[model samples]
Target: MQIVFLIEQVVNGLVLGGYYLLIALGLSLIFSVGGVVNLAHGAFYALGAYVSVQLGRHVGFGAAAAVSPVLVALIGIAFERFLLRRFYREDPILGLLVTFGLAMVAEQAIRMIWGAAPLPASLPAALRGPVIVGDFLFSRYRLLMLGVVAVVLGGIWLLLNRTSFGRVVRAGIQQPDMVAALGIRLQPYMTACVMLGVGLAALGGALFAPITTVHPAMGAEILTIAFVVVIIGGLGSFWGVVLAALLVGVVRGVSVHFAPAASEASMYVLMFVVLMIRPRGLLGEPIEKFER
Candidate 1:
């Protein structure tokens, strides 16, 4: 019985971590290559959930999922062009303040449009039951969510590691001046990074909406968790985000099972321990920007 329970918990942790991975990775992408402190990333997340839920009623969940992220991504790209681009060479605090203000505006707009009530989002009927593996069972929706996250993450890995553009992104991150001097336009790539990050944030929010409430404040709540994961995993490390998310998810799951009251606190403890051991994070390179 004990072993079965533990196995079940492990699966649950993986699924939960998938949700965290989506959010944290997006934030990392923006922070790393976009050179913007995007505090409003969470707002784009809320926008995705709300847009998907509202649009899903008419067009179906699958279509909504496909559409919401693109729309949110466009919004992010626009914001980058209109507002964030100005601060690229300025102090990081300037970007932070602008994005923070944007966050506030987004929340207020959401509250006004959606009202203060928590809207409910339902899982598709096809995903209502559990999938049994041996003697253990996992929620079908959660399993599906996990699969979706895995595919998305894999695609992201390919995008960053396989393509010609990926090489440009990698080189650009390390040597922006050199890339520009080589006649490769970095401005377009920066916009692309912001769009990609915002879109991923939206996708994460939409995927988790059926499991959690579609509320105005949901962005802030999830952002808090995602922020911690990024900090623990390292500011801009891809693999670090993946590993830290899984660790945080597993920690939260085990804590919830063993000590319900300390589920979130467990992640904090883990963060504290990891930071003490390696100040740059598990797989993170020391970021001069962070030190500044």
Candidate 2:
């Protein structure tokens, strides 16, 4: 029974980690490639959830999930092109402030559009059951979430690893001046990265909509954990984001079994420990964008 419990927690933690992975990877990329501390990233997530819920009411969850991220991406594109591009030459703090204000405005806008009340988001019938593996029963929806993450992350990896644009992004993060000198032009790529990052946050929100309350405040609620994941994973480290998200998820799950209250603080404690022991984080390489 003890071993079974441990296994259960491990599985549950992986499922929980999926939530963070979906959000944090985007943060990592945006901060890495664009040098933008986009506090508004969380608001894009909220928009995704609200949009998905509203759309799901008519179009079904499949169409809702598929379209929500695209909608957020378009909004993100507009933000990056019209607003964020102007701040690239300035201090990163300005970017932070602008995005922070965006977050506040986004929250208010979400309240106006979606109302303060929590909305219900139901899962498709195919994802609404439990999977029995011997004596243990796991959530089918969660297992489905893992599959979804795998596919999405895989696509992201291919985008960053196998494409010419990926090479430009990689170089830009490490040597922006060099890329600019080569006349590669980074603003378009940066814009794309920002849009992609916001889209990923939105995807995470839409995915979690069924499991949690779909409310305006939900984005703020998840923002702290997302930042912790990025820091502990190292800014812009792909594998680091995945590893840290999953590790924190598992630790939180295990802590819930042993000490319920500790589950809440377990992630921070882990972040502190990782920062103290290995500042760059697991699977992270030093990037110039992370420097002051």
Model 1 alpha-carbon drift over 4 Å, by segment = 287-292
- Residue-wise lDDT of candidate 1 within 17-107, one digit each (tens)? 8889999999988888856768898898999999999889999998998899999899988988999889988888889999899899999
Note the Cα lDDT for every prediction shown.
0.87, 0.88
Each model's Cα RMSD: 1.4, 1.3
Weakest 10 consecutive residues, lDDT, candidate 2? 283-292
- Tens digits of per-residue lDDT for model 2, 51-72: 8888899999878988999999
Please estimate how well model 1 matches the true structure, expressed as its whole-model Cα lDDT. 0.87
Regions of candidate 2 where Cα sits further than 4 Å from its true position: none
- Winning candidate number (lDDT): 2
Total colliding residue pairs, candidate 1:
0
TM-score of each: 0.96, 0.96
Enumerate clash totals for all models, in the order shown.
Answer: 0, 0
